[model samples]
Target: MGEKHRSRWVETLVLLVRNPMAVASSLVLLVLVIVGVFGDVLAPYGYNEQFVGDQLESPSGSHWFGTDDFGRDVFSRVLLGAEVSLRVGAVAVGISLVAGVLIGLLAGYYGRWIDDALMRFMDMLFAFPALLMAIAVLAILGRGETNAMVAIGIVYTPIFARVTRASVLTVREEVFIRASRASGAGDFRIIFRHVLPNAAPPIIVQTTISLAFAILSEAALSFIGLGTQPPDPSWGRMLSEGRGFIEQAWWMALFPGLAIFVTVLAFNVLGDALRDVLDPRQRSALSGKGAAR
Candidate 1:
């Protein structure tokens, strides 16, 4: 089993590195992480520092991106915005992943009344539009970055729950699971030790995709004054601020918007690559096709 797992991971790594899209996306994501971590060091000016004479200045040597309406460096703000976006996405996804996986495990393992009830509740949540549901939660919780994270987490929970439940249901009927049950293994042991590991691929893929959407959701919330507030540089808020002066100062909207677009695209592409790489059926099919080739 250990050898099998090792070989499986090896195959996945091989496939991932060999894929051009995956490699490129990984590099982009890597750069995003680097920027998020060292933004302060890399940025010439503070994110909120107001330049006396540079308000609405176009991209130039001192400010590669440009200056915003407040004379603050657009490059600095965009650099730091990566941290805000990534932090929100990570926390939001963490919240959903934990809650959703637990709910899914419980629902799948103890299918019947529990499954029906849990699934129905998730369905109710899923029925609402993702952004609308998030907005409603924010309305109730009041406005702020923390609240936005909570709202986004809540909105995405149903999706993760549904994905995890389907994966668990598929794993539940496997020969090894039945064998483990027959051997008097506890439910917790079987579920955690065997079931969850086997069911993780789809969940991981879902997580990556969820992160992309989470970033977008955070940006949208910030755009509407529901997320990262004043003095705190946010790409969404930057966009909101830039739209008014778009005619005269288009760089304000363009740079931050491009950041959001590129980051989301990277995550989505990585998710697609992981999905293709992680599936055993897909891996076998690829091998067969290669042999035929």
Candidate 2:
């Protein structure tokens, strides 16, 4: 089983590297991770350090991005902001993934009333628009980065729940699952060891895709004054602050906006590539086409 899994993973990776867009996007995400991890070392100035007279400065050799309204180095702020955005997305998704997967496992495994109750609850959450649900969660939880993370996590929970439940439902009836049940395996073992692993491909792809949305959600919350707060740099807050000086220092908005755009696009492209690589039907189709060619 371990060898088969390793070989499959290697093949999937080879397929991913063969796709130019996936390779490019993977490099972009890798750079984001590097920037997030080593931002302090890479940054020339403090994220909050003020230059006093250099407010709204354009891009120059001194500041790759520029200075914001507070004369804080935009490049430094953006570098650190990558960490903040990534943390928020990861925590939010982690929250949703844990809760959703557990709920889905129980609902799928038990079925009947548990399934009805859980799915109905998920359906109610799904009824609301994602951003609106996040806003509603924030309204109750109040503001700040922690609250924003919680709100976004709550907003995305239903999506993960639905996906997990669907995947679990499909996997639970398989021959291996029936054999496991007949072999007297505990519910926990079966769910985690066998079922969850099989159900993971779509979940993994969904997670990559979800990070893009999570980043956007965090930015939206920050833009409206409900996230990150002042003195802490956030890409969204940067955009909000830069809007007024857009004409004078377009670099303020342009660079951060581009950061958001590029990051989101990279995640999406990578997710699509993952989906294509992970799907057996897609793989067979590609192999068939290659053979015909």
lDDT of 2 by residue, 1-293 (tens): 67887888888887787789999999999999999999999889888899989987888899888898888999999999999999999999999888888888888888999999999999999899988888889899998999999999988888888889999999999999999999999999999989999899989998999999999999999988898898898999998988898888899888889999999999999999999989999977755765576
lDDT of each: 0.93, 0.90
Cα lDDT for residue 53, model 2?
A: 95
Model 2, runs deviating above 4 Å: 288-293
Query: 76-161 in candidate 1: lDDT tens per residue?
Result: 99999999999999999999999999999999888999999999999999999999999999999999999999999999999989
Evaluate residue 164 in candidate 1 and report its C-alpha lDDT on the 0 to 100 scale: 88
Residue pairs clashing in model 2 are none
- By TM-score, how accurate is candidate 2? 0.96
